[model samples]
Target: MRAVAVTAFGEEPQLMDVPQPEAGPGEVLVRMAVAGLNPVDWRIADGMLKDAGPQSFPMVLGTDGAGEVVAVGTGVRRFTVGDAVFGRFWRPAKGGGSYADLAVAGEKDVAQAPRSVTYATSAAVPTAGTSAYNLIEETRAGEGKRVLVVGATGGVGTFATQLAAGRGAEVLATARTTKADLMRNLGSAATVDHTAGPVAEQVLAAHPEGVDILIDLVSGPEEFGAMTRAVRDGGTAVSTTGAADADALTEQNLRGFNFHNRPSPQLLEILAGQLDAGRLTVLVGSEVALEEAPEALQLSRTGRARGKTVIAL
Candidate 1:
């Protein structure tokens, strides 16, 4: 099987002929049709998780993918051979990933791919979609609430805005001037161009009081603190990027925390429903072949991506 892999931490990724993976007990072997690129792919390649735990060398470089199940291991009953599926495929500590022709995923992490979207688009959903879902869940956002999504034009931001808006929240999204229309089309009630002025000033001017839920898709520790001030006292601020401070959260009576995205069968099912009903849009900014995955990862790491980049297998 052909795969893009990193032979060592911080080394450039390369295309190599590798052994095809086989399903183990409780796992499923998928013949990948497309693989989704995320920021983490490059982070891992650059040795970001080296101290976090052990990693398998010559690590494959992806976490999100869509493919057809070719074989199932013992105890796997949710799917059969030839079932179309999409989900996250990164090992927790070991570095094996999805940027390959074949990947082994636990049955628990795989779900039926949406019938409405193509394999490339479906491949882009799992990691970013799941993270956006987790951020929404953490904020407990819903009907009639004012939800503000900072940095709302990136991968997770795009999905977060749509999900919040779909759930009946009035979404206020932040983007560059060029992406303002795109945000509005995605269901944002209003758009703030972060490049126009300071995000804090623009947010407060739009909503005199405050927002019920604030989701920061891109923020560091200092910026996160400033954004938290825009959340109503009793409201919550959630970050997918681990930028919130716990002590400050306690002082303000505002719930603030970071969340790690967990891919679940239930969440994937809900996302599939939205996609099938034409309520959710899967945005793929670019598509490349498996051999081009290394360059794609480099671009993703720069944090300038307008939407998900997918690799066609």
Candidate 2:
């Protein structure tokens, strides 16, 4: 099997021939049709989890993919051979991952892919979509609330905008001028030009009263703090990048937390169903082949990919 992998931390990812992985107890072997690229792929390659868990050398990259089940390990009952599935496939403490022709995942990590979208689009859903879903849950956003989604043009931001809008929250999305239309179409009531000037001033000029919830996707501690200024008193501010300041938020009597995605088979199924029912959309900006994954991964790390990038097998 050919996969994009790194032989050691901080090494460049490469297309290499590796041994095929098989289903173990409670695992399902999938013949991968497509894999989704996320920023964490490069981060993991750079040793982001070196102290968090065990790791195998020559580790394959990627975490989300869509494919058909080729086989199932003993005691797995949720899926059988030939079932079409999609979900996060990274196993940090073990070896192997989704960036390959074949991958293995626990039965609890995958769900059937929706028929409305292609495998490549399905591949883009697991990580970003699930993160967006969880963020919305944490916000508890709904009618009459005003939500600001920073980095609205990125993968999770795109879905977060749609989900928040669908919940009847007035959404303000931050993006470059080129992506303002895309953000509006995803249900933002307004779009702020983050590249032109300070986003907080632009947002305040438009709303004046501050927003009910702030979802920051691309900021570090300092910038995330600046963004939090736009959140109304007693409101919530969340960052998926671990950039939220807990003490600062508490001092201000506001709720704030860094969000880390915890994916489940149930959430994947719900998100897939929403896409299939035409209630949610997954924007795939580009598709690359397996051999092109290394360059694609590099582009993702630069944070310049306009939207989700998928690797089709």
Candidate 3:
């Protein structure tokens, strides 16, 4: 089996022939069709998790993937051979990952892939979509609310915008000039150009009373403070990237928190239903072969990618 792995933290990933993984108890072996690249992939490669815990050297480097089940392990009854599934494959402790041609995931984390979308698109949905769902749920944004999504052009941001709008909130999103139309097409009622001027000023000009919910996908300390000011009193502010200040959150009448995405079988089923109903869209900007994962990972880390990039096996 061919896999791209990092022999050491901060080392370049190398494509090598490795032994194929087998299904353990309550796990299912999947013949991977595509792998999704996220910002976390590059962070892990750069040794971001070094102090947090131990990692297996020569560790495979991917979390989200879509493929067909080749075998099911003991105690697994939900899936069988030939069933199509997608989800987070790598467990932090196990070190096994979806970057390989074959990988194993616990039956609990896997869900049937949407029939409406290709495997490449389905591969892009699990992590990002689940993150978006959690963000929306945390904020409690719904009907009649004015929700703003900052950094609305990236993978999770795009899904956040659509899901917020679909929930009956008036969605306001930010993107570069090139992606303004794309953002609007995805259900944003208003779009701000982040490259043009200050994001805080642009958002305030559109909604003078402040928004009911502000979701910041990309922000630093200063940028986050400015965006937090755009949230109305009693409203919520959520950050997916670690950009919120606890002191400021207490001073102002704002609730602030960050999100770490967790995979849920129920959430995956809901997202799959949305995709099948043509209510949710997975925007895939590029598709590369498994051999090109290193390049794709770099592109995702640069924050310049317009949409999700999938690694087709």
- The lDDT values for all models are 0.86, 0.91, 0.87
Cα lDDT tens digits for candidate 3, 86-167: 9989854556578889988999898999988899989999889999998888888779999989988998999999998888
Show the colliding residue pairs in model 1.
56-95
lDDT of 1 by residue, 1-313 (tens): 8999988888899999766777888889899999999887888788888887777777888888999999999999999999999998876344477999899888999899999889998999988898888888778777889998997898898999998888889998998878888998999999888778778778787677889988998888889899877788888887777898888887999877887877798898888888999988888999998888888777876788868999998
Per-model tally of clashing residue pairs: 1, 0, 0
lDDT of 2 by residue, 100-154 (tens): 9899999999999998899998999999999999999989977999999999899
lDDT-wise, the better of 1 and 3 is: 3
In candidate 1, residue 264 scores what lDDT? 94
lDDT of 2 at 66: 98
Clashes by residue pair, model 3? none
For model 2, which pairs clash?
none
